[model samples]
Target: MKKVNYLDKFLLKVFILFVFFGSLYANDHPYIIVLGTAQDGGSPHAACKKDCCEELWDNRFLHKKVSSIAIVNPKDKKFWIIDATPDFPEQLDFLEKKTGFSLAGIFITHAHMGHYTGLLHLGREVMGSKNVPVFVMKKMKKFIESNGPWSQLVELKNIALKELSNEQFISLSTNLYIKPILVPHRDEFSETVGYQIKSKKSLIFIPDIDKWSKWSYDIRDVVQKNDYNLLDGTFYNINELPGRDMSKIPHPFIVETMELIEKDKNKVFFIHLNHTNPALKQNSLEHKNILKKGFNITKFGQKFHL
Candidate 1:
């Protein structure tokens, strides 16, 4: 009887510790949390029936949301999301429950589907949230205003679109500002931009860009200026999408990027990974190599005190 009681006490202590530390995740004030890291299509890409997506398909727990992040000021219990992805519902839910915070606004990098499509949730068809401030570039604002359902959201006053410009800094709260920088990417629908986020720590998030060479600014300079770079790591190498003509949709391959800014390894936290990338696979060579090189891989649900 004494032995059994001792074992039970040990188990109970472990459970309490787990919950306590888990709650501290978002409870840490003025922090940033990675909401998701998968690309636009997310893991288990549409129409894919491969082993890569099999486990996620079989178990919802294994599923990954599109790339997104949240900055929370727990002192005020308010938060903002970067790139409201298609997984906004779940992401917002996680933020609210974990941080005990309310959504103050959303900052968008581009008009890509995964980036802003989740704005639909704030529409009358869903949450019908009133006056949700959506910050965007001028073209991004026009893109939303000129569109159909998105325009309807503006019409219904579900969201108010605020335009930002290159190098423009908009204050979210005290010392928390979003600085937008233009980057080259496909712009059939809207202009593309990345954000230089100011919180407890500075972060640069460029989810989709043509290549490092195409940018007006040096990648190394940008990484050096910011404490964290949630950079574009969509594909591991040139051969990631076989026969897909990658040049048509150019992005700096992960391997190429790693070589380009090898000296800034410590600040590089690769994000916006596609399901096709082997780095997303657990214990893969690419994943191990990144860590071995003194770089970090941004995982879904990881938080950094900002």
Candidate 2:
């Protein structure tokens, strides 16, 4: 039998203390998890024969869901999702399996199909969730309450709409806050807004903004204030969609956004990529360029401590 030394005992105690504090720190802070990264139509878009999506049709593993993210509090066993997308069912299941937490609530960015349409899952025919608090802006609240299918969700008590005022911070949990900042977009049904989530650190999400110049607030200032920024990357550049008018479906191209914030490129993660966007291909030159330039591309399941 080997005899244990005083030094071994001291090392054992140090290791135990490290493990104890690590667990406590993880539980004390909330984090953001990326659920999906595709645009509203999703990857391998319907009725498309483009080269970018053609290979994805046969590759089930390559499919990307609509853009969405989840915030999780391990301490309380609660989590919240931003932008209940068409992929809500799978996203919800992923969160449940990943964290085993109850959904705290959902936050919607706008009335866009990819943003708010997933509330349908909580209706009578599906989960039939009871009073699932859905946070939204003023026009968004009215849009849901007044619409047919969405109104039915409200009437059946599947969801409880909570209106959020622009730039006002709302408390989600201890040391956790969320603020909505209105942005310029094609607000056909409701106004669009970006969310700023604060925990140990802050993160900014602007997945569908039309263009940075159109907004009153400076994009560079916003990027600097937040630890992480997931901005719109619907197209790699203005020439992505040929024959189709790019002006009508405007978004700050990846190149344009990159040029805007040269210094803080490390803090930015471009997301909500369209099928035609070459950056969606991991090995493509555009994707490589993004990383080479100190910027990042958001991927499904990426976790960031907040």
Candidate 3:
């Protein structure tokens, strides 16, 4: 190699940064990237002895992280996450690598262990991230403020809780905004919500919810309004859980959801699948049926420009 000058090195560094961030800020806009698609316990369900993990036991390659998505604004080198799942560490790493930005904030959907537990990783005991904005609804704000380790994260300012009203918009930039809509679900600790992220094209992210009939808003209306909808797909059917009162879990079955939708299935994507859901397997009939119906099941690392 030939000798390089001082200015050459500086320009090269700038070019490298621009190229890295360019992946996210393409066309002067950002994109929404999928991080994980599994339910609370993740795809393996730690205690599961079911055939779901029969071929995947101790197989990290076959595992799926809990459901989460990242909104990247490479122009600002900022990112916002929806739900900090148990796999936050891996998800964050993937997003950072894909977008070349640090996490600027987090927007939690609810208080489920799968949804908010990753906030603990950002607290004093772990990464110790500073002043990361965690947007939430009223009850969620109270729940975090009143809880133990989560409360400490607040006091230490590891994360800041920003209260949001239902249907209110949180503008991230000139082109980007997020709207939270309250949805009915098992609200043991805090209210559940689905978010509408609007940029070039709008997208709805609802990783978890009760049955479609239970929600006040029509699923049809939601799909009609947004460019893309990633709704809950916790189980393939009620029979997935052998003897348990499956009704207690409350998520809409994939088949039931497929039957419920009347619009373009391409606009609808099912996510937050439990480990027992055979639809996760590419070769499985359930997966083929989902595609046959024209709907999609989100896979880790799937990117949707918005």
Candidate 4:
């Protein structure tokens, strides 16, 4: 009878341990880490030593490259990068050190310099990577295939292009998938797209739409459909760049977006800020106002579990 009692207690302890570990594993979700929050040229913009830029130049205030994200698969030890910004070398280094894996592939959003220029680093003159898969839209693939310097990458087979179709879901794993959604933006060379990254527990991404009202689809509908939304926040207010004509450049200002999505604060996190935008300052009034609205502002090195 004493031997039976001992066996029962041991089984109970093993069962409890199994239950606890199962719960922990179930709660563990896949996540993406933000590498940068600044716009194309990045904070401390070129040729201008304004107070903000000058202050940022100090070692203490240095920021990462422009808006980019890394989707990490901890279990498989594989990861993918979205948007190869101007700071690709540094961003790749950071990912390599943090996740300890070379990039699996890179996804491009458009033909903009900040969006795809970093591919140069993968060429013979730089990393000399061989056959790094680069996913792009149809037009974007042609743009790179036809363009001079980029075409060289294709010829030398440094990067291979994978054409992405809109609204089609690409499964990254059993529980994670990515879908490309068309967004209205400057399509000078290629169409622009915002990715819908779906994990078991969350969904989010950078959707740089031209104007919410102008698009055939409604922005609110998209937000309602996703558990998390990291849309554009390129400017704090409409008049952010006073000297330059705002009409020439377009993005939904933070204030305007807040007004549009005031009711659905739970799903919004603003990203892709311009260098001139005061929201970059963590202690600024603009930042406080945004936080008060229950909306988050993205920062480099910040990770979100899906």
Candidate 5:
């Protein structure tokens, strides 16, 4: 056996340090990525001949998917999706390619059509994903387990449901945590929740709600407390949809929400835009007004690092 020299020992130490710090430098931060910003029906909604849907029909590039987001932990090479929207397949592929991270789990907000319907893609007929952890509130868990098609996914072991209680913190990684905050909404099937994601910088995500007034907490205070906020902008105002009684389907109009948290607009990004929302069009006057007011609208591929 030959003894190692001091020069060889020093070289070995340098190699080890290079590997350690290089790994840290490459994957030290986690982030939230905006997948889609449209409402449940998505942009260019079905069977509608309105100009909002008309314009997008010819311009496929401008089409938008339903609202959803993903929290990515690069260090672990894994990520979790907030909602499994109708655009799940595309969003999942985008996340995997963009961040090089495999999906670890999913957190559903409600049993709404867009929010959880994409779970169908995980069924045996589709991805056939085995034991994918799906976090949800009690009602949502029951709804999925008891309902057809969705229930089949559970029975086939495509996804494993994990029930969450209101306001309970779920730690995702060493520096990342998420808490489900229940909010008032049309709970026909399950409860609606907004997630508070905590890391080096925190964020509040509420894609759907009846109205800010109905929530227990003040929207102003939540905006001030979080570094980033993605709240409901389902419609620009009550007038967006003509003939239909807006009261029948209540959501905080962007105008109404702006009045409440105008001061902290910089931290806010309005999302889940209805197809008829003028703000959905980048060149529309409504879009410019939101920018002028120092508020933002979520765009596909927008990223917030933690």
Candidate 6:
């Protein structure tokens, strides 16, 4: 070996330190946790006098507001929320406790009340955040800009809207990317979308869809392409909601979804459950059957390392 000088030894030590820190930073992966799994109105919905709502009121059950998730990037100590549901305050508190107090951004999938209405909390009356970035679709961007309470948030500079394109990827870090996929749903105010979140491990989220068969796209194809699929499971059966017309409110029933995904084992996890759906109960027959069939019913506080 050649003789090493003091300057050469110093340079080698600095280079080694740089390489070690770089590897440590590169190895950190983002994590996600499901905060809620109910539909837009959520379990124990407003004006709902059903047994489910009663149970929640009496503290027998603790159903959350709606389906939403928290994505934590440990490397940056940043937290991202997907879908700002009515239960945002509680969700934020939960997130704050689980991960430190650092909210990076909020990604909205659509203009539905359950999905994006919680942006109100960021307004002057609440956190009064200065230019909190909100990632949304083009139409949703316009909708928020023109709407009343949402528009006020924009005018006050509480939230800065960032338009997202369908099927286009938004990179949060070298190891994490989120792509939005357009889905067919009630477009009374704005279009609907599902997200394909790619980390070292990818996960698909399709919270609300009109009907899988009616859509021009193939849901199965999307599931086959992703590592984990968190699909729409709004109802357990067609007649789940007693008084409502099942045809008007379209979603893939748990039974039908199970049948459709029977062949593809260990990939599907059903979410976005309605209050009427018995699958929400931990000990329910529906829940047991789903687990037995290699399907999972998404529960609040469930974490997935990505």
Candidate 5 structure quality by residue, lDDT tens digits, 1-306: 135687788899999999999878757788899999999989999988998998778888999989999999987889999999999999999999998879999999998898999999999888999999999999999999998989999999999999888998989989899999999999999998999999989999999999888889989989998999999999998888889998989999999888888577899999999999999999999999999989999999999877
Q: Which candidate should be chosen as best, given lDDT against the real structure?
A: 2
How many clashing pairs in candidate 3? 0
Worst 10 residues of 4 by lDDT: 56-65
Steric collisions counted per model: 2, 1, 0, 0, 0, 0
Model 3, range 33-92, lDDT digits (tens) per residue? 898999899877887787898668778798888999999887788889999989999999
Candidate 1 CA-lDDT value: 0.87
Model 1, residue 272: distance off in Å is 0.9
Model 2: per-residue Cα lDDT over 1-306, one tens digit each: 135687788899999999999889876689999998989989989988989998899999999999999989887889999999999999999999989888989999999889989999999999999999999999999999998899998999999999999999999988999999999999999999999999879999999988999999999998888899999999999889999999999999999999999678899998899999999989999999999999999999999899
Report RMSD for candidate 6: 5.9
The residue ranges of model 5 lying beyond 4 angstroms of the native Cα positions read 1-27
Candidate with better lDDT, 3 vs 4: 3
> What tens digits encode model 1's per-residue C-alpha lDDT throughout 1-306?
999999999999999999998888646447788999999999978877876786678778767789988888876789899888989999999989987779999989888889999999999889999999999988899989998989999999999888888998888777677788999999988889888878767988898999999999999998998888899988889888887999997889988888888577889988888888889876789999888888888988887777
Q: Candidate 2 clashing pairs?
A: 200-306
TM-score per model over all chains:
0.89, 0.96, 0.91, 0.91, 0.92, 0.89
Clash pairs of candidate 5?
none
Candidate 2: segments with Cα more than 4 A from true spot = 1-8
Sort by TM-score, top down from the best: 2, 5, 4, 3, 1, 6
Candidate 5: how large is its RMSD? 5.7
Error of 3 at 121 (Å): 1.1
Q: Considering every candidate listed, which one attains the maximal TM-score?
A: 2
Clashing pairs in 4: none
Candidate 4 Cα deviation (angstroms), residue 258: 0.3
